[model samples]
Target: MKQIVIIMIIASMLLFTSAAATILPPPDLETQGILLTTDVSALGIFSNNADLSWRHSSEVLDANLNLVDIVWDPETGLPVVDPETGELIEIWELQPEPPLKYDSASFEVQMATVYSEDTSAQYGEIAYSKNSMVDTKALPASMSNVENDRIITYTGLNGNRILSKENLMLSGAGTPGVPSALSTTCAQCIPPGCTCYPAFCSFVDTGSKIDMSIVSATTSGEVRNLNKIGGGDGERWPPIPSVDGPAHMSYSIRVAELSSSQPSVGYVSTYLNLENSEAGAWCVGIPSLMQELSINERKSVDGYVSLFSNLVNYESAICR
Candidate 1:
């Protein structure tokens, strides 16, 4: 009898263990109380009062990606929130993740500094260090008269914390678009004398509820009458559609002077001409960018529940 009991107990334990293992699904967004959807319109707005209940759900299961906190200085570790004013104050820096480097041929990334304007803690200002990453195709298709202008594209904050600003612009000045890793090698990459651009974006506040907007800019500008470029339109350029979704909108920046000849800011006056080809025609601006980066306030899977929990908890403390 005793032997039989022992065997039964062992069997029960084995069953429980097996059940637990099977129940442990893969890392996913749905397990975190979210519905993974590429539809940007479904994500809702970036405002604090915006309602996400309609888009909220607890069903996703496959994890798409993961984000890790880079870490901060002990001095910068402890966060400061003005008790009276209810503001957050701390030092933040941008660092790029692997598969992407500041001087990669694909894209260049650099960290930027963000400073609070007043003690109010409601907003802040940011400025780049003139450093940039120029890729192999350093110059965008729209670039004219400049051969060294490279255009590299990448994701993530690149170690630089996003300041409490309303807008951000990442440019390689005059070079071909290269991979994110080799962005810093070309002679005319950025910083004038340096081979690449330094860090520029940072901050992990997906809670500040800043709003989200994603923009894909190309270098197809009309250089009409001067030399008829062989392309879709004599002056107008062909649109490069985004594969991500309709939520992903693209724009074109012309480095042309208001006039045909003179250049401003060492480059021609830059202009962002937006296209209306997106599925939902979603808008891309500073506020929109914030929302997208915030993971659309969605939850994570059971495996990644801890990460999402930590991020949410962290945001509460950081954005206070």
Candidate 2:
């Protein structure tokens, strides 16, 4: 019962408020101070109730006796169990619980949005605020390296409506290299014996079923072959130039238009002669949105669209 009383007192400290006590009030001076025992059982009593004792001091006088100072262990709130021992002794103390750490990211976006309204004043105040930039860092130049390294590769159905690996094949002797120049023969691989017409790198809107075309034209065909993929051919191609190729290959590929709606989807359209085994205009890094549109469309609108969209997303994600 005594131990229960001590626990109840400790528990009460936790509640914000407690109901009026119906239980009897603790003993007062009129009842005389409790005489604590030497045994641990009696010490348990001091541990529970208000077992503090008082010593008469030369302070002030009460109604019938001299006023006394109620004593407690100077180090702990608890009273010592030994009644006769006058010297102060230590008692076990309880520590208050620590407060929780708050998360700032949870509120950063909302605060930033509001700050944008009144740029100078509001932003200045935010800057002066305590630890406003905690955990955030300046934009790093090497995030580009991280993004490139994080490029995810996907493998499934090559997303291209026409000229996809599924529907095209090569005609020239082995893959085109140095002296060979780039060339390919088109055939509808989807339906065996369906002779292909001309090849188109991108989409084409034809009113009816048509044959895919195949042609090859390279301005510096004999000059830009490096790494000897095409052997010591005509003038050695000049370092397989990039988009603004010093010497570019312009070819018209005939593509089948199954439907005007389901457009092809992929990356830039260009014949790749990296490996001698597979040489054709293949998409880079997983198929992109470029595969669906015509080559002209990809070069014009799609190029700008990709560039601007990437810029916007990058700014939003990192600049703030």
Candidate 3:
């Protein structure tokens, strides 16, 4: 009877241990991804000769962060008990997680404008302020060689200057019949029927400004999942990983002629290109306005009235 009772107790204890093991589930392992979008808009104004006009522009951006790999804690999810130490000995450790991947990331900018007068009647020009890029991971550092090796120079009608990759300049000559300053060296050399105007419309040199923001994933999807998995021995589990911070890109334009025109619109766009991939994002900022002005004939008589509409389009691409 004593031996039978002892055997029964041992069997009950074994059954209980087996049930506890079954209740403890394996560590959860599911991959996840992140998506983000941002948008902004503003109003601008251009005025001259007591005439005022307003314009509007807007921008939008989108980004996607995907998981590519994960690394598991060495002792968190292991099987086997050590008889000597009375502790669970780790038999196999999970492999290290792969690097985080960025996919389907893109940014776009669109703009529209309205004016009280026809701006196209007069000669006008549009140009980008500058170009800029920012990344938290210093990824641009790897492409410095490619960027530094290339330089673009632009020669305008009156003079030449380095043009920003983000900006486009489209300008027209002065009034067709009006003599330009470049036509002759003498200020009085104007023909009997010709009146001299500046070589180009002084209003053609307006500049633009832009501002932008963005966010991206820096860790693998598997690592992000570890934070949700609760049960792990304090000694074997690793600290939870944190998410990456947002990145920023911005630029501005400044010209002497358009110095007084207040810029109400700031737009920024960006994209993350995968390794050996050709994917990229397209961005554009366009400002439109109309101006009504009276041209003086012979510098005295009221000349024919004309309306001008100016549409300036700035475009660029982002690839990472």
| Cα misplacement distance, residue 18 of candidate 3 (Å) | 48
Better of 2 and 3 by lDDT: 3
TM-scores vs. true structure, each candidate: 0.14, 0.11, 0.16
lDDT of each: 0.17, 0.15, 0.18
In model 3, where do residues sit more than 4 Å from their true spots?
1-247, 257-320
Candidates ranked, most accurate by TM-score first: 3, 1, 2
Best-first order by lDDT: 3, 1, 2
The TM-score of candidate 2 is: 0.11
For TM-score, the strongest prediction is 3
Residue 188 of model 3 has an lDDT of 39
Query: Tens digits of per-residue lDDT for model 1 on 1-320?
Result: 11110000000001111000000001111222222111111122111111121111011112111222333447868556766855454343344333232122222211111111100111222211111211211122233211111121111132221211111111111111221111222233223332222221222212111110111111211110011111112221111111110011111222212222221111011112111110111112211222111122322121101011111111000000
Tell me the tens digit of each residue's lDDT in model 2 across 28-85: 1222212222212111111111111121101111211211344576688766666575
Candidate that beats the other on lDDT, 1 or 2, i.e. the better one: 1
lDDT of residue 303 for candidate 2 = 14
